[model samples]
Target: MKKLLLFVIVFSVLSAATVTFWAHQPIIGMEEKPIEFSIKAGSGVRSSVEQIASAGVPVNPTLLGFLARLSGKSGRLKAGNYELKPGTTPLALIDQLARGEFAQEALVIIEGWTFRQMRQAVASHPALKHDTAALSDQELLAKINPQYGKPEGLFFPDTYLFAKGASDLQVYKQAHSLLQKRLNEAWGRRDPSLPYKSSYEALIMASIVEKETGQKSERNMIAAVFINRLKRGMLLQTDPTVIYGMGDAFKGNIRKRDLETDTPYNTYTRAGLPPTPIALPGAESLEAALNPAKTDALYFVSRGNGTSVFSSNLNDHNRAVNKYQR
Candidate 1:
């Protein structure tokens, strides 16, 4: 009976204090800087408050939990990582928890970046949980799905927003899913006469177009030049493919022998698409690959002003190349 009476008295004091003082009081241990904490999925009000307290955020867990229950917000508690900042009142904290406002982070995967570059960026991201950091490239692909044989050009380039502390794989999965959606949709709406044997081949063409198009507006023309080359049984002969084949050996320049060297990605030495994508391709590149411009042009020369000049024959291409490149 005394213990019950003591509990009622303490609860009464906290309730009265909340109206005038307690709810407005600043939480302890966050004056210097904000602290990040997490409430695990399925955690109740007491567990969440205690977890925050355990992370050195000194708040009256019992009183907060009691107030939450009294205010009919106990069942509304949402889980995820959160930030506890200085001057955060008890009422505001509860509201934050109730609204499921998780701390968010943005990661950008750039278009035309290699798979290795993408991996490096993801590995070095500070906000991610790094669950896939130790996984091998193939193993990482397997973690996403066993059907994935390679990682290159498989992920879409975009800004992804995820809850802070989310697994890095979440970003990967989101990108992969989005890329597949875009690729499949583009394939479905593709020009029927395109020379690609499959959607994957279109993806390879997209990667090539992404790399070779120096000007953003010339993607369709670049795709057409390559498509014309492919249809005529001529070499794709793209420099980026040769550089991709050279791997670390490329020193910011492509030599004659480098183009002559036989590798799966050396389009100068091989007649068909490379074994895998060489870089991530953006949606515009994919669209261009599926629907190249209708043109007789089989060659392109960069105009040195971030644009290209196309030619239907070798003589004109050589003249343009001499004017711009030589």
Candidate 2:
């Protein structure tokens, strides 16, 4: 009976050793990698030391289980993109997942995106899930209002980093907070001679500038034309605002009828700044609006070659418009 018991003990020890060795063998022909990434849909796969060993990967499930038990961490796996390495032990991978080391992704918001456009861009991201289409502008404004007073032109445009499964609200809050900080700083340093009554008005002007020109160097000139219009109480007559009012139904081009169509956002029909900004403005646009060049320009018409002709009077503007537009 004693001999049989000794043999049983040896057999059990040998079995455990074999399992340990099998679990830790490097995968044959698998080159060393700095990080390993896996893309799995639905739900991630459940991995164990024995399972990995049986599948022929160099991983030690027993060691992972032992360490997890020792560290008082069991059944704590998080789902998301992950970066791991072959050099990483099974215990390390387990610990990494348990500690929630999920990969991150980034999204960049451009200078002149409207709230609707921003929502669409965010909704299209694979990692983020939200029904932005169902939410009305009012609902979106309300949701973002706690952080941004007017939602329009309130969020700063910039590249932001986010973990996988990040919420749309989270992204908005972050953008809003960053915008508040940057706008406040810029507003404090604005040119003293700017005609705006408040920083909000400056932001509204910036949004117009942002929509009017993509050329960074031309922002100040565009802003100057708007300021000139404001000083003379001339209508802004900007076409971008008309397009904005039409919303998504705005078929890709601007037409003469569309410009004449009455809408609250149509700067041609409405006097002074619109009730709200047309889109989110970036720092450069904001600065340009606040510090427009000293010029007598009162009118501008796009020359159709990615440039606009500026004029101090309507006749000059019309001549340039006829020359370039026609």
Q: Pick the candidate with the highest lDDT.
A: 1
Number of backbone collisions per candidate? 0, 3
Clashing pairs in 1: none
Against the reference, the lDDT scores of all candidates come to 0.89, 0.75
Candidate 1: list runs displaced more than 4 Å. Answer: 1-35, 40-42, 53-63, 84-92
Compared with the true structure, what per-residue lDDT tens digits does model 1 show for residues 215-276? 88899999999998888899999999999988899999888998889998999889978888
Model 1, C-alpha of 3: deviation from truth (Å):
26
Q: Candidate 2 — what's its lDDT?
A: 0.75
Model 1 lDDT on a 0 to 1 scale: 0.89
TM-score of every candidate: 0.84, 0.72
After superposing candidate 2 on the true structure, give the runs of residues whose Cα lies further than 4 Å from its correct spot.
1-58, 64-81, 85-101, 131-134, 146-150
